[model samples]
Target: MRQLRRLVLMAVCSTLVVASPTRSLAREGVTQQVHEARQEGSVWTAFAFNRHLSPFSLNVDVEGSVATLTGTVENEVKRELAEQVALGIDGIETVDNRIRVDPGVRPRLVSVAAVDERLDDATVEARVKSKLLWNTRTEGLDIGVESREGLVTLSGESASAQARELAGKLAASTEGVERVDNAIRVTGEPGTVARAQSEVAQAGNLLGDAWITGRVKTRFLSSDNLGALDISVRTDEGVVHLAGTVATAAEKELAVETARNVRGVLDVQAASLKVAG
Candidate 1:
C-alpha cells in the first residue's frame, strides 16, 4: 500500500511538470502572434495611407497596439485620411497622428542638402505677405511675417478667431510656404498676462499680443547676431513661437535669448526652428 501511494504521488508530480511547460509554451506562442499581428497592422496601415495619400510623405510606427503616424501631408483632408486608415487597422489600439500639412509644397524625393537649396527665405516671406495682404479678410491687419526654409510664421493680433484662422490659411496657401504656424492671437477675449493664463479686463488691452509681436520683431531686426528675415517669430499672448532656420547654432541661441529678453514675452519656444546644416 505504501509503494502504491508513492507511485501515485510521483505520477501526479510528473503530470504537473509536463503540463506546466506546455502551458508556458502556449502562452509564449500567443504572445508572439500578438506581436506579429501588431507588425502586420503597421504595414497594412502604411500601405493604406500611401495608396490614398500618394502625393504626401507619411510614415507609420507601431508598438504593441499603438500606431504613430508622422511626416508631412498635403492639406487637411490627407492628414485626416491618414489617421483614419491607421485607426481602421485591426490590431491597432490607438493612433497618434502628428502629420503636418504642407499647403504650398508637395511630396518629393530629395536630400537634406537639396532642401537647403530651395527657395530663399526673403522671397518666401514676401510671397506670403502679399498673399495675406491680398486676402480681403486679413488685409489692413498688422500681421508680423517671417519665413525660413519655406515655412512662414504669422504673429500679431486678430479681431476674432475666424480672422486669425483665415490669416493662417492664407499663409499656408501662398506660393512658397511649405507650412505655417499661425501664432496670431485673437483680441477682445482677454489680455495675455502669462504664457498660458490671461485675465479679463475692462474692454482694454485688446492689442497686447500685437504689441509684443512688434516689439520682438523690432529687437530681432536690431540684433546683429540674428537674421530677422531668416527666422519667423510669432507671439501668442506673450508666448513666443520661433519657426524657420538660422545660419548656425550660435544664431539660434541668440534668437531664442533675444525673444526671451523681450519686455512682454512670457516664454520662448523654438521647437520649429531648425538650423541649417
Candidate 2:
C-alpha cells in the first residue's frame, strides 16, 4: 500500500513539473531585468553630456532589445550620432532614431562660439581623419579627408556605396565640421562588363524601365535609413521587384515604401525578407 501511494505521488509531481511553463517565465524575467537595468543607467542623461550628442534635445525609450530615439538635433549628423550612441549601449538590438534636424541652429551656434575662435581647418581635418580611422564602418576604406574653412570633403574609392555614405557621416559628425562633400566613387566588380551586357540583353527594349530601376537604386543608396547593400531591385515596365534580406521588419517596410513612392514606380513587389538572427 505504501509503495502504491509513493508511485502515485511521484506521477503527480512529474505532471506538475511538465505543466509549469517555466521556460517562458524565465525569458520574460530576463527581459524585464534588462529593461530595468537600462532605465537605471540613465541613458538620456548620458546623451546630454556626450560631446557629439550634447547639442540635441534627446529622449530615449527602451523596449525589449530596441531603443527608440525621439527629439530634435541640430543637423543630420547629430541625428545619426544619436542613433549610433544608443546602438552602442549593451543589450540593444535595434535603434529607431527619429531626430528632427534644425539646420538654422548651426549659424547661431557658430556665432555663440565666435568669442572662442573656430577650430582651424587643419585641426578640423585632423579630427575628422582620426574619427574615420577609429570608426569600424569606414576605417578599412582608403578614403581621404580635407577641410577648408569649415567645409570638409571626402574623396577616394570605397568598396561599396555604404562605405562612401559612412565616410561622409564620419566627417560631418566631427565637432568643427560645417558640411561634408562626399565624392567617393564605388569601385565596380570584376564582372561588371559581363553583368551590364547580360542586363541590357535581358531587358532589351525596356530602356525607360531600366532608368526607373536605376533611380530607385540610387534613392535607396542615398537614404540614411535604408541600406541597399544586400537589396536587389529590378523593374519591368513600371513594376518594381525588390529581393533581399534586411536587419528587421522595419527595414523591409522602409525599402518597399521607398520603392513604391518613386515617381515612375506603378507597382512594387517585394518578397518577404529574412530578418537577421
What TM-score does each of the candidates earn? Answer: 0.28, 0.28
The collision pairs in model 1 are: none
lDDT (C-alpha) at residue 234 in model 2: 71
lDDT of 2 by residue, 1-277 (tens): 4345446545644554577667335434433633433331335534633556755556666667777788877778878887777776667768887778887654223221321122244345545654554344454466776777789989888777776776787678776788899998999432111112221122222223534555566567667877435787777767899887888888888888998997658789987456677
**Backbone clash numbers for all candidates listed:** 0, 0
Off by over 4 Å in 2: 1-42, 105-277
**What is the model-wide C-alpha lDDT for candidate 2?**
0.60
Error of 2 at 226 (Å): 42
